[model samples]
Target: MKKVLVLAEARDGQLRNVSLEALAAASTLADGGEVTAAVFGSNAAELAATLGQHGASTVYTADHSALAQYTPDAYTQALVQLIELANPDAVVLGHTAIGRDVAPRVAARLGYGLVSDVTSLEAGEVFVRPIYAGKAIQQRKFVDGKTFVTIRPNNIAIGAADASKTATVVPVELEIKDLRSIVKEVVRKTSGKVDLSEAKVIISGGRGVKSAEGFNTLNELADVLGAAVGASRGACDADYCDYSMQIGQTGKVVTPDLYIACGISGAIQHLAGMSSSKVIVAINKDPEAPIFQVADYGIVGDLFEVVPLLTAEFKKVLV
Candidate 1:
């Protein structure tokens, strides 16, 4: 029997969906044993019930001033203590920015091997991770000792929520102190738009969009669908969009439910990032654009004319 522990990550006082997805992965890792969770900082307890609904039998919360905002020092300290208390066979985390930075510290401090960006679990023990820009997948497993894993969001299927199941909430005292950095304030890039990494639908522009003004058309469509806007590396390199919105081999890897590629030529690097999307829609004037190869739906047209038409049509259907 295996016991799994998941770090229930919260952002802006709200629980992140990836944390629940990680809980789903934890259930798989548990292998007929128990699944537990932990949330840190202010109002941590409030998030415990959600973890419970997602399959966590017990939820541990650690509240501390140092943990109010994410700092590696404070979170690492809290998680280390939580690990000691849970003594779980496996530790699972979402592969978000905070998880990426802190999971390594926890593994190193505990002298455990860590697996990052795990995409799938096979045969109960083998973990699958995409490598070399999705050109290949590597299967990994723990030889001995506690297992530490960080799962890529949207890859794992979140299990059914059981409202009947409730977790026992426990408070773990934290001694977090002497943080090297504290976030004074968070400056958001988008004005309350959906977070790109977790968005269910994504509309991405490419260099073929011509200019930053072209993105405005895409943004309009994104707003209509309540989706997030992304860009190909070519678009960012051409100064058509911010690097933050870039999606390619060196940029963000996204696996949304629907991915619309507008004016993208489908460079291999760009495909590396978004090829795994559930449904891909590619719109381009060129019939032979490489983007068509992976697209579930393809439209051959001028985006300037096509995008507005799509936006108008979608608005009628959606709202």
Candidate 2:
């Protein structure tokens, strides 16, 4: 039987949600095969147990000080060794920052095929992914010996957990080599309600918002709905908001449950980021705004008047 491997990511003993989703995908792929997960951290055993609940049968742990920091070389070496030992038919990973860096190198090292940012996976290893910045969808077939795939966050629903199951932990033997790049310092913004990519719901603004103060209205709505804030490329380019908040082809791609676009004339680039959302609501005074074409719900009215009303109504209902 072919074996499926899931690369798990952990931070301070807490497992990343994407890892569980990958496990779920692995479980589906492991119908007649074995499913396993691998992690590199101190408490990887506990993380392996959690991964088992999602369907991993075995877990490989590689704990070391060099593995603590996310250096591409260290992670690639660890995963390369694990893959060499396990020799799984397929390896599943989250299309996250770390995975994006390491997955390709691992594939190249093993002379394996890779499909990145996959939104859907099939039993036969057929995959679906976005192209041209989500403007078009592409279905791809993997006709190779071994395959590596990365799952886009929020695109796949996480399966129910089975806590009764536990994965066998296998420790990996690795020798760290001095790499070219070193992480000097890690700095994070202290003020933020949620990470845009991880947010379940998001409220985004655009050039029509007029000024930086326009984000205030969107924030009110986001607070009422407990959603993260987003901005369009136009707003970011105009210096109305930071580049981090921009959602477009060149920016972050998000697949939240609910996406609300305010004062935004949806361009194709902007739609690429949030178009995969389950529910899309657009508020624009222009009836012909491209946003309406994709929005499940559209309100043709000034955002200044419409957003406050929606915020008030949401606060009243939820509170």
Model-by-model lDDT, in order?
Answer: 0.90, 0.87
After superposition, the stretches of candidate 2 with alpha carbons farther than 4 Å from their true spots are 11-13
TM-score of each: 0.95, 0.93
Candidate 1 per-residue lDDT, tens place, 21-74, comes to 999888888888999999987899999888999999999988888888888988
Kindly report the root-mean-square deviation of model 1 from the true structure over all alpha carbons: 1.5
Q: Give the TM-score of candidate 2.
A: 0.93
Looking at model 1, residue 204 earns an lDDT score of: 98
Who wins the lDDT comparison?
1
Clashes of each: 0, 0
Least accurate stretch of 10 residues (summed lDDT) in model 1?
A: 186-195
TM-score, cand. 1: 0.95
lDDT (Cα, 0-100) at 121 in candidate 1: 88
Window of ten residues with lowest summed lDDT in model 2: 186-195
